[model samples]
Target chain A: MKILEDEKIVGLFFERNEKALRETEASCGALLRKTAKAILESDSDVEECLNDTLLSLWQNIPPAVPKSLRAYACKVIRNLAFKRLEYGLALKRSINSELPLDELEAVLFDLKTENEFSDVEFTLTLDSFLGSLSAESRAVFLKRYFFCDTVPQIAQDLCISESKVNSLLYRARKKLRSVYEKGAEL
Target chain B: MKKYRLSKALGEIDEVYIEEVLKYTEDAAAGKRRGIFGRKRIVTLALAAVFIAAGTTVTFAAACGGLQSISEHFTAYRTDIKGVGDTSSLPVIENAWSIGKTMDGEQDALAGSIKVTSAVCDRYSLYATIEFNAEGIDIPENIPDEELTFDIINAKSGIEGACRPVFVSREGDIFTYIIHFSESSSINGDEIFIEAHNFGRSCTVEIENIGRRLVFNSVEYCRIKFSIPVSDLLILDSVQSLNSEKIDGIIDMDAELSPFGFVVRYDESQVPAWEEAHSELLKQYGWEWFKYSTGTVYSLLSFKMKDGSTLENVHNLIATAESGSDPNSGKDTIHFSFIVPVDISQIESVTYLGAEFRFDAEAYD
Candidate 1:
């Protein structure tokens, strides 16, 4: 939040509270870049997303009067970058044709399976579901999903395991689906 | 250094959407200013135009359609010698096509090979009449061979150019040729003539000197030159699958390669050094096996949920739809699959998915 336009720490960017901007980028920029890079995979796209995040914070700080600067920057950058990726059609131009996900889709969400859950009224609940998880777990989940990093990549980042990363992801997905099903009375 | 890598990571990200949001805010501010005293409408419009233009370039490289071929043959592989002798049953192969290459290092040689071809010009002290292959030739997508392996080396003694394979395929017919006439420090040798099984198809075979005279002693080179006939050179293989319930997958070979004269970790007990080296070489097999496999291993994830879509789906979507490397599995497809549980809650809910995914990978020789 750019609440303090002159708060010495946030005063580096041309005397425009640069510290707040810097802190926002340092803290949230990492997460934001990881997410953008995962989806876009293009160096230019990821960098663009990061740059936009900083500029957005710079422009929005005065009037919006933010509270959590990191959160604000991340939210903005992530949405914008994701739009670029989606409309940009990154998914359509996949490099990993043998990606296990598509295979699972072939079986898991085949016409028959989707037909069963079509009217299941799945509200897609993640708020409490994630709130229950430890911060570390949430980070892993975010890194894995948000950034689409591999288990080893996440393990290297979190200093965990390729196996542990997989375990956590599996449990999280299964639990989330079950909980969502229950919420939807599926 | 890590910070630099991180910066490089963020250098190319986009923020157009963020710019749009700010533009909206700026617009609102400008509108309020204009409302005060019959302000200039042209001024506000110009300001908005400037804001939009500022964020317009949007030089974003969207990972989109880049599938080079329908069926891929990977040459990189990881080999294990202990089990290799037990060719009891083949590894379970799946929707994949793979090839393995290893440098001939048994005699402390670099990654070069010596096959006795018909073009053997023995008079010139040439062991094998070898001709180099062309640059890139179109190879068969569907073949019966399970796990193709090539003993490749940096041109060693008696070889000249890069004896690389140039595959160019049009429609169904394929034209493949191997040419070996260039190298870091070697010369092209006579061709071991071998009649082409398929007409108009010549197997280019060039040989490099056995002992590499690398310019810098510290930078010792490892050369591998394979001298097989055009027919033999074209080892059309697929991951052969055995029908068995024990393993619900296809059986493929794993090959490995290391720096010439590179030491192996486990060369003691019973497995010979060559055996160990052979096994390690299997890790990278033409990138075909890896490309098709679903793994949480290495650059791949075993399971992930993105907007209700599995990580596997997202990855394969990008991999299948686009061209050139997966974000996770830098090589073409899932190089190796490992299962690791990732917290899905951190990502957007099932409907609000991120690019995360998961799947399994199992390969055998």
Candidate 2:
């Protein structure tokens, strides 16, 4: 199927046209598959995840006119991939994903058991912290962690050295740790 | 805390971060052709997400540019900027496209209410669209464009400039004002104070002695003020000037790569033959009679990359050809500001109409 314009594809979905899914697959299938493969190893799970994502889009797009379909679809696929990972892990299955969560885990390791903040507060604090960063530094951090790209991948994409990417993450973590420590003191 | 708990917190950060990441990833995957206009919307959406994620109850409604000035320019290129597209997936020529902040709420004006709907700014210009609602007032058609005026004040830098409406339209109870300011006006600050006023007069054109004239009737003055906190914009401090070979000896084209956009400046008086040939056409096309100093050159120009790729999705092509002697060149000048940002290093040439002005790669230092 030929790739249709985003608005056209959305219109098709609203009109209940099955071609909307085909067009979406035509445009977004490769990216979704790549994102799923980054986290999930099994081909069968990846295929099932893609189907689940499409069903979710069909249900969601009627009420949600997503500004960027790519972002919306990718987020859905990423969430589904994470869910699949969790399911696999519950069965004691070893996963091959070296995701950015591993790196973020190190930064948040010092959160004391008696911290006063909830998850919502932590999320807000993180948003404010990211907002305080310079545009370049923020872009680098998001590329590495939020988008689940490797350090070398981010370095190459931004035309920077791998060491620079490491240093940026170091500074970001240091800043986050400082904020978290302060919150703990409060 | 357990490591798994930390992972959970990271995953729950918010949609704003997700949007930003997706923007970069999508842009990389798309190979960045789509244009800055699309990315600009994503930037706005992300801005709204930031506020919403911060627990603000303020809802974000995308207010695209309603400027005929900008819309007309983009129309020729087969792009409609009035609606959202996959702008976040586009790569910028330079980082000319920066995100803008939304206002906290609508500001009540003397006659009605006014709201600054959207703004896309760089060091060179702050392009803002203001929406005006005059509830009880019955606005008639054919209101003279000269009745309203906009003044912008940079709160932090204390710099101020006046803006003329590039585009203005009324739909029933609403009037949209689209305006811009050049770098000389100092648009670098992150927060701006806007004062929009309407002169107490109603005017119309009258044909007298084979000439058009503006006649005005006195009315009550109406004013509104708005305070907007914007984000940091790109500064074009490293501007480079390129003087191309003289065109037919009458004009020497000089171009500057500014953070706001690409500008091509030339002597307005050099092309008399061009003026004489296109005076009637220019008038019929709604160009100001007095400001028609330069010959009618093609206003719709194209910026080309090194690989012979044309920037087709660019917006805001503002051209000013007024009669003013240039202080440096001592000649009347015509200035063209194409809001499409370009990487000077990557740009191979600028094509205006059919004339190709190629840049010397070796001279770029």
Candidate 3:
């Protein structure tokens, strides 16, 4: 079927038309699955995460008219997948521990200090930091940290060398570290 | 903050940032015009030579035509690298040729054809554009871009490399894509094959006059062949030994410089000594010590040009590779590729780790 525009899909959600889920699946199901697969290892878990994403979209759309359904669905799927990943790790499952979270931890090492900031405040700081970056840097940062794309994958997708991806990540992480350092001083 | 908390906070970032990345990926995939809001188009003279072969017209466009476009396109996409992507800079492809060919038999099977519009190469990479035409096939509007995929293979060796196709544009029934091949080994061939596979998508097709909608999957596959003397492309073979002090146990340094970029490789043989040098900071930073140490090492590197200008703190190093993982093993080959394009012929010396490695007259031999 022809993919419906995101606005039309949102309108369907507002109307409580069940077809919205079908359209959503058709339009962004691949993206949602790809997002989940990036974080969750098991296909079953990925399927479950996709279902939860759809359910959340169904329950939340009337109150949340996202500008891009694809982006909104991705966030929901990623969060659900992360929850599954954490639960699996807690249960001592054989989940791989090679997530880029460790790298992110290193990048934000200054945040270990005792000062408390609301999630909103932290997110705002991150948004400002991202805003200060060049478009290429910002995209690479988000693709690696936010999208959980592998370095090789990012390199291939952007038509650059794998080392280039690593360098970009390193530079962005350094910049982020300085951002946190400046924030601590403030 | 904990990593999970930081990740959660990252999730809560404004959707605009997320959208920006998504749009960038889509544009990159499509080979859409790039640079500061996609407004910059660096122009160069592109010579196109057209001829007929086997009743089909084949075109051999000078590779220089697409080299600047490809370089500038990448430059715009990689603005984070200092001194790289300047349109005024010299073209990276010293001698270039772009060959375009049409699929011979695949058109009869699918009622459409795939074409290679342009292919070019530099010293280290190959860039090509492919166009898929579905003139007779009825594809639904707004189909997912992932429904289609393409691959590149070396015709001589029959070896295929991981090729990602970026969508360029769609006009009428033709879709354009651009692919890059970076493996120096795979790209040395004179002929290459491009395979396009449509994994089929559910599209609603209306009965001509009855207005009845029917959903069906459209799967198609085709392979197009093209030949270009990639080996004929200019190769700049300039490798110089880097001179550095014995302070940190890192030794035996060398650099390969080209108009595209420079790569520095060295052996970190005295791991214990290196760790001891930074032991105090390492203890203080814990898990972050490695990052700090590496960042400091990178900051100490600079390039001295023949024009007497210094490219200081060349922090835009784009790629790094290490062979040995065990820190206790005391033998690791560390490689760094700086993404900033520089005229290697104009370079005078490299200052790395507080010692200057000059490109003196004797060293050129």
Candidate 4:
């Protein structure tokens, strides 16, 4: 599962190695499954998401060499689980996540509609949303979500005023809460 | 969801989703490690399926600065040129005769002859290997690739039939050439010359050399290079030009393709498989074909009729098999054999099996 270990095993994945693929799933199974479970709250949905995520990873990784194999798994599973969550909604009209949904609500609100990042159906939507936010807003968001980046770390990472990180967090949360209640239809 | 789980999920989103994203970080890291030499040789078999890119060991400085030059000339047609010559330009080609073209575009030399198919002036150090079998060629698009071809001819002009090369050195029997292209490929107005030299039994044709060194080691799959010679020209030297305009004209030959002979010559063991237009053969050669457990694979027959005359006429005719075992493997080397068409000289284009096909093979010598 490690991207840059020995190139032979890496080559197996590159060669569409079925055994190495089976091993990849087995190796990363626990973390991927647990991550999916936390987001979807359904074992069946989590399993489905894990399978889809792995398949996409298998298909995409040859061209896209990930820096951190673990981060790669996280990015894929999160986006897929989120997309499935959107589709399983009671109605397309309920485009916004409920504030109580808690985890993805902040990032989801700032994100553009899914159709905007069409070719990049995998992670493009999230990337665009993160890009559109101010550098401060994104740093705080990643600190809270992407990296569990601490307040001090975010301050260091952003080279910014510590208060700026705190304020960006508060503003992002407030906007997400309103958008969640309004339920932007898209 | 549990509170602990929720926090964990939020904190790990980037890690969770890494699989599906196209991360180019590895490639970027390669560039930073050592300018060009520090970079890993990533042979991305992106589009060309069987293309074997060994991240060719191109010298670092040469690769970076020469990539553009490598691609441009490799994509263009080359013509025959020579800077030095002990040759002649008169009515006699082998000292005692002249080659004469028939009214129907057929050529005749007394007994011995050598004709230049095409040639080009190459300036870059490149190596090429071109092979012709039934399975077509597979040239790497972004790598330096080359192919050379040659034909035998007689030098005498008084003899009226069957002319071949005169005194083709053992080294001269093989011609040599090179090509290097990257990223994109073009198929417009390209030509290469196959020299019929008297160098020896083998050919001694010269190819490209860059940075002032001859690239003579990197050849694969053909012997035409024996008759060719790599000239010592650090600067581009125009190859002696011939009246032949371009070498892109197709060859129409009735001579059975070599792979066709592999099966037909050994038809004793698998007669049943050979009956129908062998579906498995077609599939093996990367054709869209299907095979039943029994006699449903091949659909082509030798065009038979109630009359014996039609049967006789069809004996040496050609038709491609439409079936094979595994179509996508592209490891197919179907076996077959048939007489070379007597009127092969009338046709100009190289004839291939009757289907849309692309091979790891390149231009003919």
Q: Which candidate is the best by lDDT?
A: 3
Best by TM-score: 3
Residue-pair clash count for candidate 4: 112
- Evaluated at residue A77, the lDDT of candidate 1 is 67
TM-score of chain A of 2: 0.85
Considering the two chains of model 4, state its CAPRI-style docking category.
incorrect
DockQ score for model 2, please? 0.10
The runs of at least 3 residues in candidate 4 whose Cα sits more than 4 Å from the true structure, single-residue gaps closed, are: A1-9, A91-140, A143-168, A171-186, B1-365
DockQ for every prediction shown:
0.01, 0.10, 0.17, 0.06
Lowest-lDDT window of 10 residues in candidate 3 chain B?
B35-44
lDDT of 2 by residue, B1-365 (tens): 54355444545555566566655454433432321111122122355456557764332333434434334433422233222133322223321222234463334444666666555554345666666666665444456543633333222231245655543565666666655654322242335666656523434666777676654442324556676664423233324355464554445666545434544445443444454466687557755322342334343445566765565333233333222222233333334444443335555665653445666432222
Per-residue error for A76 in candidate 3, Å, reads 0.9
Error of 3 at B5 (Å): 1.8
Candidate 1 lDDT score relative to the true structure: 0.32
Clashing pairs in 3: A1-B202, A111-B1, A163-B319, A164-B318, B29-B166, B29-B167, B30-B167, B30-B168, B63-B96, B63-B97
Reference interface contacts recovered per candidate: 0.00, 0.27, 0.39, 0.10
- Give the runs in model 2 whose Cα sits over 4 Å from its true position: A64-67, A113-115, A183-186, B9-16, B25-365
Candidate 2: residue A58 lDDT (0-100): 97
Model 2 Cα RMSD, Å?
22.4
